[model samples]
Target: MMTRIKYRFLPFLLVIILFVSTLTAPVSYSVQEPIMPDSEEARKILEDSLSIVEIDHEIERITARQQELEVTQRQLRERITVLEERIDERRDRADAVLRAYYMGERDHLLVMLLSAQSLSGFFRILDFYDMIIQNDQQVLQSYNQQYRELQASRASAERNAAELAQVKDSLLQQRERVLALQQQVDGALNTSGNPEAMRALIHEFTLYWENVGLYEVKRHFQALASAMENLPGFIQGSKNILSTNGKVYTINIHEDDLNGFLRSEDKLFETFAFRFEDGKVIASGESGNLSLLIEGRYSVVDEPQNAIMFEVERLVFNRLELPDTTRRSLQDEFDMNFYPKQLISFLKATEVSSSDQRLIVRMELDL
Candidate 1:
C-alpha cells in the first residue's frame, strides 16, 4: 500500500518539475525585413545624384562668371561717367576761354597799348595778347581730345552692359535646368527604388505607345517630361512626346521667345534656329550649333493633343569627337534625363483627348 502511494506521488512531482522548467526557459522571436532595390537601379539613382551635383557645379561656375561680368560692367559704367564729367569740365573751360577771346579782349589790349608811355610797354602788351590767344587754342584742343575719349568710353560701356545682360539671361536658364534635373532625380529615387512602381511605369509607358502603333526602344520619355514643369516657360515646350526609336536626340526651338532654353546652355544653338521637318532628329555641341552635328530630330504628334516627340535613331555614347570633360558631363546629363520618372511633369501638364488616352513620354539614351 505504501509503495502504491509513493508511485502516485512520483507522477505528481514529475508534472510539477516540468511546469517549473517551462517557466524558466528563454523565449525568442524574429521579424522579416523588406528588400531594397536592385544593384542596377541603385546605381542608376546614384548616377543621377552625381549628375545633379555636377550640374550644380556648372551652375556655380556660371553664377561666378555672371558676377564677374556684372562687376566689369559696373566698372565700365563708372569709367564712362568719370570720362563724361571730365569732358564737361574741359568744355566749360574751353567755352570760358572762347568768351574771353570774343568779349573785346583785343580792344582792351589795344587801349592798354595806347596808354603805355614807352615803346617797350606797348610791345609787352602785344606779347600778352598773343599769349592769351595761344592759351585759348590749347584749351580748345584739350577739350576736343577729352570729348573724343568720352565717346569711346561710352561706346565701350554700352557693349559691356549688353554682354552682362546676355550672361544674366544664361544664369536664369542654367538655374532652371538645375531645378528640372533635381526634380527628375528625386522622382527617380521615389519610383525606381520600388520594384513594383518601376514595373508599373514600364508597363504603362509601353502599353500607351504600343497601342498607338509605336514601339519605344526604352521607357525614358516619362523622365524627361517630369522635369519640364520645373523648367522655364521655354523648355516646357518639350512635353507630351512619345519616341518610337531607341536613341536620344536634342530639342531645337524655332520661336524667338523660346530662345532662352537653347541659350541657357551657353548659346549652344548659336543663331541658327534648327527646324525639325516632321521626321528628322539631331543633337549638336554645347558650344555652338554649327560646330558639329551628331544627327538627331524631333516631331509633333497632333493626334495626342500636340505631343512633341524627339527621336534619336543612332546614338553614340561617349563620342571621342567631344572633349573628355564635356563627354563625361554630357553622359551624366543623358543618363540623368533618361530615367522613367524624369520629365513626367511635362507629360502630365499636356491637354489629352481622353482619360484613357492620357499623354505618354519616352526619352531613351545610350549612355
Candidate 2:
C-alpha cells in the first residue's frame, strides 16, 4: 500500500515541476533590443521619415483631386462643344428657311392660284392654295422651333463654359498651393543638412500644423493653465487678465503695439480688419497715415461659446521706413521672405484685442 501511494505522489510532484519549468523557461530566454536605436540620431531619422510620409500623403490627395477636377472640366467642355455644334446646325437651317422666303418662293404659289380656268379648276386651285399655305406654315413653324432650340442650346453651352472655367481656376489654385507646400517641405528638409534631421524637422512641423485645430487649441490652453497654476508670477498675472466673457492680456512691447508695428516686416501679424458677411470675409479695411483704424462690421454668425474665430482678409504694414540694420533684424525675426497678400482668405485668427482697432493675430492656434 505504501509503495502504491509513493508512485502516485511521485507522478504528481513531477507534473508540478514540469509546469514550473515551463513558466520559468520564457524568462530565461535571451532578450533582444528593438531594431531602432534609442538615441537623438534615431529619433531625428524617425521624424524625418514621418515628415516625408505626410508630404507624400498630402501630395497624393492633392493630385487625386486635381485629376478629378480635370476629368470633370473635360467632360463639361465636351458637352458644351456638342451643344454649340447642334446650335450652329440649327442656326444654319433657320438661315436657309429665311433665305428661301426672302428669295420670293411664295410668289410662285400666288401665280399658280391665279392660273385656275373652270369651276372645277378653281376648286382644285383652292385645294392647291390650302396645300401651299400648309407647306409655308409648316416651314415657318419648323424655323421658329429650330430658332428656339438654338437659343436654348446656346444658353446651356454658355453655362457649361462658365462652369468649366471655374473648375479650371480652382484646379490651378490648388496646384499652386500644392507646389508652395512642397517647396516649403523641401526647404525645411534641405536646411537641416542631415537628411535624417531634415526629415524629423519636417515631420514635427507637419504634425504641428496638422493638429492645430479648435479642440487642440483648447487643450493647449488648459495645459498651459495647469502648468502655471503653482507659479507665483502666473497666478498674479492671471487675475488681471481674467475678464467677464474671456481674458485679455496686454503686451506693451513696441513690436506688439499696432500703432508702431512694422507692417512691412510684420505683415503676417498686421492689424488689417476684415468685413465678415454671411460667415465669409467680403472685404478688408485699408490702413491710412492715422494709427487708429476702426472696422464697424458686425458678425454674421452667432458667437461660439468659449471661443472666438476671426478671418483675416488683408494685412496692413507700418509705413515707417526703418534703418537698414533694423529692417534686416525685423525681417530675420519675422521670417519675412514672403509678402502677405491683401486677399488672404486662408489666414484665420487665433487671438484678438478688445480695443476699437481690434489688434488681431493670425496664429497656428485654432481659436
Candidate 3:
C-alpha cells in the first residue's frame, strides 16, 4: 500500500518541479512571432553590400594611381632641374657668338671682303662668312631645342599634379558612395520583416563564411594564433602580476586577451571581438553580411556551487535581437565558461568585477 502511494505521488512531484522551473527561468519570451523578412529587403541588403565592395575596389585603384603620379612627379622635378642648368650654360655661350654675328651684319665682314687682294682671297672671305652664319644658326637651334624640352617637362609635371588631385577627389567620392551603401544596408536590415528570421538567416550566413574561412579572416587568425592558441592558454598568460602572497589570489584579464584567443582559437569565432563596459561584456562578430553581438555578464553561480560562469543577456544578429527561442537554439555555439585550472591550482573564484580596462577576478582557497 505504501509503495502504491509513493508511485501516485511521483507524477504530482514532477508537475510541481516543472511549474517552479517555469517561474524561475529567465523571462525572454516574445509575445509576438519573430518577423520574417520578405524578398525586397533581402535584395536590398545584397545590393548594398556588393556596392560597398565595388567602391572599396575603386578606392584601391585610385590609391595605386596616386602613388604612380607621385613617383612621376619626382622624376619630372629632377629632369627639369638638369634642363635648366644646361639651358643657362648654352645661353651664355650663344650670347657671345650672337654679338659677333650682329657686328658682321653692320660692316666688319664687308670691310674684310673689300680688302681681299686676289680672287682666291675674296672666295675664302665669302666662304668664311657663310660658315660663321651657319655656325650661329646651329647654336640658336640647340638653345631653342633645350628650352622646348624644358617646357615640355614642366607641362608634364603640371598635368601629373592635376591628375593626382583628381584621383584624390575620386577617392573621396568613392568614400561617400560606400557610406551611402552602409546606410542602405542599415535601413534595409531595420525595416525587414521578422527580426528573428533575419537573425536566423544571418546566423546561417555567418556559419557558412566561418566554415569556408575567407582568406583575409584566416590571415587575421593566423597572426593572432602564433601568440595564443586557446582560451585557457590566454587566461593563464594574463598572470602579469600574480597575487600569491595573500589568502586571495587574483588575475586581471582584459577584453583583448579573450578576444584574441577566441578569434584565433576557433575559426567559427574568428570574427568575434570583445569589449567590457560597466562590468558587462559586449562581444561582437561579423560573418558575411551579418554581425553578431552578444552582451553577457559574469557571475558566480549560486545554487549548485560557486563557479564563475558567463551568461548571455542579449544576442543581436545583424542589428536585430534574436527572440529567446532563437537564442536558446543558437546560444550553445557562443557558450563560454572560464576554467582557471592552470591559472590557479586549487583556488576558487569568489568574485568577478570590472574596472576601466580589465576584468579582475578574486580567488580564495576553498578551505
Candidate 4:
C-alpha cells in the first residue's frame, strides 16, 4: 500500500513540474514597426500634409484680403460722409451768394459810381465796379466746378464700394473652396477609418521635419562659423575701425588674435545663425560688412559706403534640401514656383530682430 501511494504522488509531482517549466519558458510575439519617412506610405502622407498646409495659408491670405476690403469700404464711407458735408456747405454758400446778388446789389453799385466827385474818381469807381462783377462771376464758376467734382467723387466712391463688396464676396467664396479642399484632404487621410491616427502621424511628421531641418541648419551654421574662424584674427591693441557715411567706427578690442572679430566667440556662428520652423526663415546677426571690409582691406577714405544687409536668407534657402517630388508638390500646393519665393513667404510669416551685435534666425518650412 505504501509503495502504490508513493508512485501516485510522484506522477502528480511530475505534472506540476512540467506546468511550471512551461510558464518559465520565454514566448515570442510580433510587433508593428514604425513607418519611415522615406517609405511610399510616408510620401502619400506628406502629400496630404502639404495640401493641408497650403489650404491653411490660402485661408489666411483670403481672410486678410477680406479684412483689407472691409477697410477700403470703411474708408470709402468716411470719404462719402466728408464729401456730403462739403457739398451741403458749398450749396449753402452758393445759395447765399445768389440771394445777396439778386436781391440787394445791382442798383447800389451804379449809384456809387454816379456819386464820384471827379473824373479820375469816376474812372476808379467804374474799374472797381467792373472788378466786383468779375469776382462774383468767378465765385459762381468756382462753386459750379466744386459741385461737379463732388458729384464725380461721390460716383467714384460708390463704384469703389460696390467693387469692394463684390471682391469680399469672391473672397468668401474662395475661403469656402479652400475649406472644401481641406475636407477632401481629410477624407483622403481618413481612408483607414482612423482620422485621428492620420492626424497624429501628421503631427509627428511636423515635429520630425522641424527637428531634422533645425539640426541641418544648425550644422550648416556651425560649418560656416568654423570656416569663418580661419579668417584673419584681430591683433591685440590694433585699431580695428570701420567707416561708413564718411564716419569711422572703432571695433571692440579683444585680448588675443584668436578672439576674432564679428561675433567669432559666439557659439556655432561668427556672423549669423539660423533655425527653421513653420515654413518661415528668420535671420538676425551682425552684418557681414565687417568681414568683407576686413577681408578686402577697404580704405575708409575711399567713399561713403552703405552697410550691406547680408543675404544670409539666400544661403539658408539654398542649403535646404527636399526630395524633387516633394518640391514639386510644394510648388503645386503653395504656388511656390521658386525656392526663394518659398523662403520669402516663410520669412514674412516669421518675426526677427538683428540689432545691437546679436544674431538670431528662425525659419519655418513644410518638410
Candidate 5:
C-alpha cells in the first residue's frame, strides 16, 4: 500500500517540476522584417529628380532671355509711341497754320488800321500798317518753317516705325528659336534614358545662341548706317545763320502758291535762282504772255534771252507784305512757316560780280 501511495505522489511531483521549469526557461520570439522595394525603383526616382533639376536650369535660362527681350521690346515700343505722338502734334500744328493762312484771317489787321479815325488815329493807322506788314512777314515765315519741320518729323516717325517693325520681327524669330530649343530640351527630358536625344538638344541650344549673336551684330550695323546717312544733314541744318556774313543768293517764289516749291521745277531756272544773290537783281520783270509753240506745245515767258534764266524750282516764303485792306482777313491764315535756313545760308554765301553788261554769281550745289 505504501508503494502504491508513492507512485501517485510521483505524478504530482513531476507536474510541479514541469511547471517550475516552464517558468524558469528563457522566452524567445522571432519577428519577420519586411523586405524594402528594389534599388532600380529608387534609382529611377533619383534620375527623375536629376531631370527636374536640369529642366529647371534650362527654364531659368529661357526665362532670363525672355525677360531681357521683353524689356527691349517695351523700350522700342515706347520710343515708337513717343515718336508717333510727336508726329501727330507737329501735323496738327501744320494743319492749323495752313487753315489760318487759307482763310484770310490775316485781314483783321486792315480792319484795326481802318477803324482809327483821329489824326493820332491816322498816325496810329500808319504805325499799324507797318506793324501789320511786319506781322504778315512773320506769319509767312512761321508757316514755311513749321511745314518743313513737320516733314522732318514725319520722316523721323517713318524711320522709327521701320526700326520698331524690324525689332518686333527679330524678337518673334528669337522667340520661335527659344521655343524650339525648349521643345528639344523637353523631349530630351522625357527620353532621359536616350543619350542621342540629350546630345541633339544641346546642339540645338548652341545653334540658337549663335543665331542670337548674329542678330545683335546685324542690328548694330544697321544702326550705324542710319546714323551716318542722317548726321550730316542735321549738322548743316542746325548751324547758326544769323552769325554768317552773307547776302541772300536766291529768291524763288512759286506762281500757283498752292503746290509750293519743288526741287524739280527746271534746271536752268533753279540754277539761276541759286546763283542770284539778294543784291544781284538790278531789274525785275514778270510777264503774263502765254505762247503756243509749233502745234500742241505750250510755253510761258519765252526762253529768256542771253540772260541766264532759272525756273523757280521751289518757292520758299521768307516774308509776306499783304495789302492793308486784306491784312485783317489773312491774319490768322499764315503761321508756322518753315524757312530753309540751310538753303538760305547757302544762297547768302554765294558771291556776285558784275561785268560790263551782265551780272555773274557763283553758286555751289550739294550732290
Candidate 6:
C-alpha cells in the first residue's frame, strides 16, 4: 500500500516540479537591436552628413542675403513711388503755367507785343511779355529735370527688382538642396546606431575640410566660377581637362595638379604625392628621414544616393601602421574631403571614380 501511495505522490511531485520550471524559465525578446553599418557604408553616410552641414551653411548665407535684398528692394520701390508722384505733380504745375501763358494769348508773343495801345504802354507790355516767356521756359526746364530724375529712380528700382529676383531664385535652390541632403541623412542615420556620435564625427570632419584641407581649392574654384560666369574657359588649353561633347567633362587630378593648385600653401599634404590603385588612394611622403603612407578607399555609394566618397583606411609611418588613436587623430586633423561645391555649382559632377594610377571626375559641362 505504501509503495503504491509513494508512486502516486511521485507523479504529483513531477507535476509540481514541471510547474516550477515553467515559472522560472528565462524570458527572451523577439525584436533585435539595429546593427551599425559596415565601415565603408558608414563612411559614405558620414560624407552625406557633411554635405548636409555644407548645405545648411549655404542656406543660412542665402537667407541673410535674401533679407538684405528684400530690404533694399523695398526702399528702392518707395523711392521710385516718391519720384513718380513728384514727377507727376511737377508736370501738372508746368502744364498749368504753360497753359495759362499760351492760352491767355492764343497767338504769338509778337502779336501780343504789337497789340499795345501807346508806344510807352507797348514798351511796358513788351517787358511784361518777355518776363512771362522767361518764367514759362524755367517751368518747362524744371519739369524736364524732374522727369529725368524720375527715370533714373525707376531704373534703380528696376535693377533692385532684378537682383532681388535672382537672390530669391538662389535662396530657393539652396533650400531645395538642403532638403535633399537632409532626407539622405535621415535615411542613413535610421540604419545607424548612436546617431549623435555619428553626427558629431561628421561635423568634426567637416571642420577639418573647412579649416585644414582643400580650403585653397575651394576658394580658387569659387573665384574661377565667378570670373567665368557662363564661359567654359576653365578647360581651354588645359591638359588636365578632358571633354568629349563639351557637355560632359573629365578631369584627372594628381600630385602635380595639387602642387600647382596649392602653390606654397603650408599644409601637411604638400609633402605627399597622391595616386590611385585598385580603388584605393595612396599617398607617400618623406620629410628628413621620416616616411609616411596614407591609404584611402574610394567607392560609389548608392543607398542614400548615388555618390562617390574617399575614406581614409590606414596610416603607416616609417613602414609601420600607426595605432588607431593616432590614425583617428590625424584623420580628423587632415581629412581630404574632395567635394568641391563651387565647381559642382558650375559643372555638376555626374560620376566620380578611381582606377589604377588615376582618380577622375566626370561632370556635366556647365550650369
Ten-residue segment with the worst summed lDDT in candidate 2? 335-344
Worst 10 residues of 1 by lDDT: 212-221
Estimated TM-score for each candidate = 0.38, 0.32, 0.41, 0.40, 0.25, 0.46
Q: If candidate 1 were superposed on the true structure by all CA atoms, what would the RMSD be?
A: 25.7
State the TM-score for model 3.
Answer: 0.41
lDDT of 3 by residue, 1-367 (tens): 9999999999999999999999999533222222334576674464355446546656787789889999999999999999999999889878878777666653677789899999999999999978877887888889999999999999999999999899888778878878887787767777876656664655554444334322333333344334332555555555673565578787777777666566565666566677887989776778555456668778876445555677768765545443333333233433355555445667778889765757788888866
lDDT of each: 0.50, 0.42, 0.67, 0.48, 0.39, 0.61
Give the distance in Å from residue 365's predicted Cα in candidate 6 to where it truly belongs: 28
Best by TM-score: 6
Per-residue C-alpha lDDT of model 6 across residues 1-367, encoded as one tens digit per residue? 9999999899899999999998998533232212333587676776565556655666676678879878887887787788788888888989898787668653566786788789998898788878877887888898899888878877887887888788788778767776886788778777787788787666665554455333433333243223333223333445755555667767675546544444334344456566766767776776544456668776544444334445668765433343333344344444344433344555545677667666677766444
Ten contiguous residues with the weakest lDDT in model 3: 27-36
Off by over 4 Å in 5: 1-125, 185-367
Q: Where in model 3 is the C-alpha error above 4 Å?
A: 1-37, 103-106, 183-367
- TM-score, structure 2 vs. true: 0.32
Query: Candidate 2: deviation at residue 134, Å?
Result: 4.8
Candidate that scores best on lDDT = 3
- In every candidate, how many clashes are there? 21, 5, 3, 14, 39, 0
lDDT of 5 by residue, 93-166 (tens): 55665676689765676776677778798787788678856765666666566556656656665665666566
For candidate 1, lDDT tens digit of each residue in 1-367?
9999999899899999999998988532132112323466654544344344445656676678778878887887788788888888898999898777689656787788789988998889878878977888889999998888888877877887787788778768766776876687567756754756654444443233233211111122222333333443434455533333435433323333333444454332453233333344343333211123343334444444334434444332212122122334333444322222233333322221111212223343423
Better of 4 and 6 by lDDT: 6
